[model samples]
Target: MLAPFLIMLREGVEAALIVGIIASYLKQVGRSDMMPAVWLGILTAVALALFVGTGLQMVSAEFPQKEQELFEALVGVVAVAVLTSMVFWMRKAARSIKGELHASVDRALSGSAFALIAMVFLAVAREGLESVFFLLAIFQQSNDALAPLGALLGVAAAVVIGYGIYAGGVRLDLRRFFRWTGVFILFVAAGLLANAVKAFHEAGLWNGLQETAFDISHILPADGPLGSLLSGMLGYRDAPTVGEVIVYVVFLAATLIPFLAPASPATSRAAARPARQKV
Candidate 1:
């Protein structure tokens, strides 16, 4: 439940930031008339995300047992990939995002209306798609009703925060927020990757190491309240397979090492600078 909420919160803030940037740029250039294009793009992206998520859920309901496992594995893998890419992309893009958006707005303003709409659509759609994948992966694993409720709350919070930022009523240390959140996301992705490996093994697609890494079920059953919470948030498996452990460790090492390493002088400076929120 918490997993989807945080994922959606981060993703929602990203989408909101992109839209806010575009809107502010339009006003700066006296092209506020094009604001409708931006709204059109945002609404279209939201519709696209909802349609795709619903369609996928409906289709998954019809799969056989083995096929369902395979589908889950695929979804998990895709989600992990998308999650990793988004984390790194945000880390690199944070510094120059405003400038890049401004440049794109300049070009869009000079081009056809279609170009302006496309710019906003692509920016928002990318984040929406990321949320869909993460949410679906999480939903498949937990199948908890509270997950959706948590997601709704997270999105509501994000909207309120975004509005506050836009209205200049809020002051956030966005860099620190993103940095810590990115770390948390890495832990979540590691669990997802481990679960994906387990799923593939269950599907009989990868059966190399079948040995159990350890069994803590006696102490902490996966279905227990705390266990379920851990399972959902950290992908806790009482009797994890060897492959699952290996994949989890490998993913963490590959991603976390670089993520936790010291930032370059320029990147540090950029992170240290106050966040710019113009709307």
Candidate 2:
């Protein structure tokens, strides 16, 4: 529950931030009349995302047990890939997101209303698709109704926080927030990768690699509350298969090293300027 909550909170806050920036910019430029189109596009994106998630869930429910495992494994792998890319993309794009958004908005306004609508739809839909995919992967792992409830609450909280920020009622250290959250997400994705491999093995897609590396089930059962949290957030399997362990270690090592490396000097300077000005 806590895991889903945090994941959704971070995702929701990001979507909200994007929308808020667009809206704020529109207002600033005296183009508030076009705001309705943006809202419509956003609503459409939300509806489409919900439809896709529900449809996939229903379709997957009809599969046989083994097939279901395969489906879940596929979803887990795709979600991990998407989420990992998203984290890194955001880190790289954050510096120029405002300028890019403004330019897109300018182009949209210059084109037909349909183009403007498409712009808004694409922006919101990108985030919506990401959230739906991630949630689907999480739901498969959790198998608990409470996880969705937690996600809803997270999104609600994020909305409030986002509104506060946009309204100038709150100040956030956004760089710190994203940096910590990115690290957390990296661990989560690593766990998902390991789980994906386990699922594949269970489905007989992979064989002869079923050795258990170690059994810590006596000390930390994965089903326990703390263990579940860790498992959900950081792939903490108590008795992981050798393949799963290898995948987890490799994924973390490959991703984390580059992520922890120092940023380009120019990028560092640009990131620092906003905080310095704010201070």
Candidate 3:
């Protein structure tokens, strides 16, 4: 539940930020009459995301047991890849996102109405699609009823935050917010990597290195209340296999180090630009 909540909140806010920037640019350029096209694009992107998510779920429902495991494993791997890319991309893009978006809006406005719709659709669609994959992976890993509720709450909160920002009723250090969330998402992605490895082993696609790293089920079973929460959030396991443990450790080491490193000079300059300009 916690996993879905954070993922959705982050992704939702990102989509909102994209749309908000585009809207702001349009108004600034006295193109407010084209606002309907922006809303149309958002609605189309959202509908497409829902359709894709539903289609994937329905297709998975028809798979046999082994096939289902394989599918889940594939989904887990893709989810991790997508989530990791998103985190890193946002970190790099956040600084100049407003400028880039404004430029795109300018180009879009110079073109046909279709161009305007396409601009907004493509921007928001990326975020929506990313959210879909992450949510699908989370749903596959946990069957808790609270997962959907968490997603709803997260998205609702993101909407409020986005609105507040656009209305100039709220102020936040977006740099810090994204930095902390990026770290959290990295942790989640690591867990997804481990889970993917376990799923592969279960599906019989990975047979070598079949060894138990440790067994803590005797003390704290993963199904236990606290254990379940941890498992759902951090991919905790009672008795993880050797492959799972190794993959989990490697993922964390590789990603966390780079993520924690200081921002590049270009990135630092971009990040500092907004702070210098009084809102």
Please rank every candidate by lDDT, starting with the best: 3, 1, 2
1-279 per-residue lDDT for model 2 (tens digits): 777788888888888888888889889889999989988888999999999999999999999999999999999998998889888887877776777777788888898777767888888888888888888998887655688888899899999989998899989887778777888888888888888898888898987568999998999998898887787667688998889988988998998888867799998788656534432
Clashing pairs in 1: none
**Candidate 3: which pairs clash?**
none
Q: Which candidate is the best by TM-score?
A: 3
Q: Assess each prediction's global lDDT (C-alpha) against the native.
A: 0.85, 0.84, 0.87
lDDT of 1 by residue, 1-279 (tens): 898788888888888888887887788888999999998988999999999999999999999998999999899899999999998888877877887788788889889888999999899899888888888889888756799998998899888888787777988777777777888888888998888888888898989877999999999999889898888888888999888889988999999989878789987677535334321
Instruction: Please give the RMSD to the true structure for each candidate, in Å.
Output: 2.6, 2.8, 2.2
Candidate 1's error at 229, in angstroms? 1.1
Estimate candidate 1's alpha-carbon lDDT, on a 0 to 1 scale: 0.85
How many clashes in each candidate?
0, 0, 0
Candidate 1 vs candidate 3, TM-score winner: 3
- Superposed on all Cα atoms, model 3 deviates from the true structure by an RMSD in Å of 2.2
lDDT of 3 by residue, 166-256 (tens): 8889896888888888999998998888888878888889986669999999899999998999888888999998888889899989988
